[model samples]
Target chain A: MTGASPADTAVQGTVAQPEWQQLDRRSIWVAPVQPLAGLLLAGLVAITFRGWDRFGVIEPAIGAAVAIGVFALSAWHWRTTRYRITPTHVEMTSGMLVRKHRSVARDRLRSVDLTSDVVHRLAGLSVVAIGTGRQGGESDDELKLDSVTTEEAERLRRLLLDRGSRAPAVAVADPGGPAEPAPLARFEASWVKLAPLSIMGLVALAVLAGGAAQLARSVGGDEIWRSGPVRGAWDWVVATPILTVVIGGLVGLLVLNAVLSTVLYVLFYGGYTLVRADDGTLRISYGLLTQRSVSIEERRIRGVRMDEPLMLQLGRGARLRVVAAGLGTKDGEGKEKKDSDMLLPTAPAAVAHRVTADVLGTPTSPVGAPMRRHPVAALRILLLQGVSLALVPAAVLLMLALVGLVPHWIWQVLLLLVVPAVVGAWLEYRNLGHARVGEFLVAQGGPAGRHTVAVRTDGIIAWQFRRTVFQRRPRVLTAIAAVAAGKGTQTIKYALQDDVLPVARDCVPGLLDPFLEPDHP
Target chain B: MRLRPPNNPVHPRATTWWRLQDAGFYLVVLVVAAGALFWVSTAWLVGVVAVIVVVGAVDIVVTPPIRYRKHRWEVTDQAVYVRTGFFVEDWRVAPLSRVQTVDTKRGPLQQWLGLSTVTITTASTAGELKIKGLERGFAAELVEQLTAATEATPGDAT
Candidate 1:
């Protein structure tokens, strides 16, 4: 209902602003629209199939009408939808039947990320994704401009950043100093090739094998190539114990695939650059198939993580990821989604740390100590597990004997439960240790493989001391550490009751005091 | 760290009531289980009536004389402390700095009694601390106090 106001038409700088009418008209068919239309058509066709079974003659005509109706609705919606960016806010108005209008204040804008797929490229239009924090009770804000020129996107970004400085909480650093662009670090796609290839290939092979097995079962038939002599021969070839000779042949093929994909992606993202723009914005641009450019305000980053998988660790390579608020990186569990903030999948730890520091606006020091389960706690855990396992089987056997159902196998059942319980208890005992380093507490415990959960003193949301009836008598308690990662909580449990309070205090000063009174202490 | 008298009248006698109620609940559960067991043992319809009568008599005898001791929170500059437990006595304290949000609610019974429940949420993993059965006027005052403290304090990152 509101037309573009006089303020919206004001162009910054001397750049000539193209008349709104001159912009590409085809931008209406954004990435989602085409797929959505296609889905609607498919649904119509399915409806037609049901109609044909009921009333044969009118089905085809009805299907055609339905298809036309869907297409018309999509076109109508696309034509009516419009977006504009003023210096103060980003405005979007859409919906044909039910008109909706939304706007985000420029100052509240935290980041702008641009992504385009094949469909977007073909249309010669890109999507500008704008993110903003919640103010008042409003939760999340995102604005996606369906069709916009690259130049227009850049102009909008600059204008928003310019206006953002005026807001109360938005602080804009001065860009007066001589621009010292960091030396462009050249990383060959070939250097860290083997790790991704082998991992991906193994996963692919597993998936293919699973699919093939499922298909074979469903068909209830086996082909000669898949299940007969050829399969056996293939298995024998792969099973050869000469590790060097066998893997040596496959390594080239694996590396080639990895390098090929990486090179393709790099080529598509030819002008890939991560630079601090004049206004202190971290701008990252990359594209091969569909170009992507993202700019994030430095202060918005909450934390940084350097992740090293087993193979990457072995190769002395670590991936860097930034934990930026309002980035929408979280999945259902509030864990950061994979491929989100993947600055570099395989970079030197030093470079990773430097980048992380620059992005997060903090010193790149590891914040927390790894917590490990106490040795005595492990023994107790083992005992507890052993008792639980023993009791379950003992109860089952006693019930069976009382019912005269399986009285003969009571001793056998007891033996079955006891042996495994003893082994499991020993495994549990071997995996407990807790330690404090500086202001971080690290707790490690599990069976066989250990998990070390580290928490910074300041990051802990709350600490709880829980004791069961048995534990209270033993003077033992479980301490749980809660950390806020996006929406959900990350909890770390330590089963050492005796020394947990003191260690927690040392790691996180003033943590235990709030829960305990001075007079009582 | 001055401690003021509890805003709500602390009933020390409630502890006895709490113990009795807990015991009574367990006793009722035991009687029901016993009645079921006796009914299973007996084949005659009259035996079932006998089992029911015995359970009812036990429940009636154990129903009264239940009382519960209560404690109320006294807010300090740094923390709010509430001490209330029967056999396993425990005290809870929540710091103002760590407090994320303060919520107040009154249930049907609490409303009838002019009492309210105050919940304090912290960033800590322990979740939230709740102090219930405080006077309505006291709860409002506590909310106002906590909200002001939260706003006055600078955001602590670490």
Candidate 2:
């Protein structure tokens, strides 16, 4: 039975079998939430059946049947789940009716991680997942052992990752171990300052407002959320002086969004701590009730990103994320990248850069490389693009004006928008900088806010240059550097036509030389 | 473009493909224009039909020969360069290392003409680049060469 035909999981029977570890018995306490929901659904269905509405016993019986069935299934699943970590492989077998045996080779293991929620933590249990980093079949390549003790999760990560990779001699979180220098860093309560400044707060507030509005609409009582204050605000604005109205609306939105963001930031990143562990690994642990820990091997980390939205930038704050493969992009993996991959919630830009440098094992942050500006034509292109974008709304306004559908005064507002549009274009052009760092190419883009992404030049697998009819006129083209990790495409947009050849060559030297060489034409 | 050194050209029968496509295009347009004419005996419809027919004929007769002259495909040591698109010429370079897969396809008409299309899929989401109208033998060789080159360049970047 051990001599499996599946070659990837092959093991020599001569070796002592690894001890099989069952998940904490407390795991039974954390039954799947689906059954309760299913019970409710069953009750609803029971009601829909003719005459069942008049029979309370029938409804309760149906609810009890579904509820009991769900609980029984969860209990069985928890009871049968078993896993083991060996020197060369991590194996898992689980399932009530249909058994699933998954084994990943030590050499193939790319990630070892854990997660928990309030209920799981209360029961002293955590979910452990092992990954091969291969992409296919909805997380088939990953093996999950749900609801293990926190201590067991740490030991499994160390024993599996360290022995499997010839990783630096392992240490069990001992501060004084010669194997690991005192953590490169630990959580600082002050880092929470970054949380409130993060744009996630604003985004969260917007999402919350949208969700509330949608909920209101679905419940058929949107008047309270939609029109009550918003319409009142418009009326108030009409009554107030023009300057006061504009200022009041702007200030109110800004303040409310900021406060909401702060609340969300604290809730998610409250006890976040990042520590350098044995063998060039980073241990990231965070959360309040649902504490989780993620171990990132340096070898798997292809790049680090420092994101600074307008608000974060204004506060000199930046959030850090690792641009690595298999962390979140793939299915049945890290469910929320925002919560999982974030290295820093929010920190002073300088401190964030310093941490970036430390994790990257370099004195200078790759993202810190000074960006080289795009040509002046790029600025012109940006302005023209912005103007064209505004033209659509302007055309609609004109059409509406013809029908007396909109105030002609609004035309003046559209006219006024020309200034900001141009300014925005100018800002975008300024941010559209590209630079070649050591072994990495940096591409920065965006307007008002900027995203400067740097990927190892060696990691880039493909290059693309697209020139439209409009771009041809301006002698500019968009060049994309395709990497295997992160969002995949890091674009150098609106590059001067003349600059295209040199940039392409620099990104991957000699690849485009034959095509770029000028011929008789 | 007129003076550019000629690179590898696809099969001569590619012109048949282009002419057939052009005919199909005009056929659709003709039905729509004729249907409009049936509704109103406008004299302008005749003029429009004449213009369309003339343009379609000229294009059918003229474009494929010139386009076959411009379209080129080559495999470099570093990358696969495909130059196509007559008016707005697109010259793409897919590095051998970045090639994820190489495939060849043939339509019914192409099969009758022994023509095949070679496609090179790369990691970049720029959409795969296709070299069409290759002689079947040449297309197969191209796929083999691309696959070998891709394997030869271990861990090549996109």
- Poorest lDDT segment (10 consecutive residues) of candidate 2 chain A: A1-10
lDDT of each candidate versus the true structure: 0.55, 0.70
Give the number of colliding residue pairs in candidate 1.
29
Chain A of candidate 2 compared with the true chain A, TM-score = 0.78
Q: For residues A1-521, could you state the per-residue lDDT of candidate 1 as single tens digits? A: 23333343444434343223222455644544566665555545344333335546575566567667765765676677776655455677777878988877766777777776667777766667776754112234566666576655555566565542333212232232355466233344543443452244455556666765655443333442455566887777777777865686588657765655455545544555677765556776666676776777755544444555545545555555554545555322234433435454455556665665555444433422344555365467567768687878678777787878876567565766767677777765664555665454555555543333434555555554454445555555555554442332322333555566666555546645544433233
List the lowest-lDDT window of 10 residues for candidate 1 chain B.
Answer: B1-10
Candidate 2 accuracy as TM-score: 0.78
Model 1 lDDT, residue A247, Cα: 82
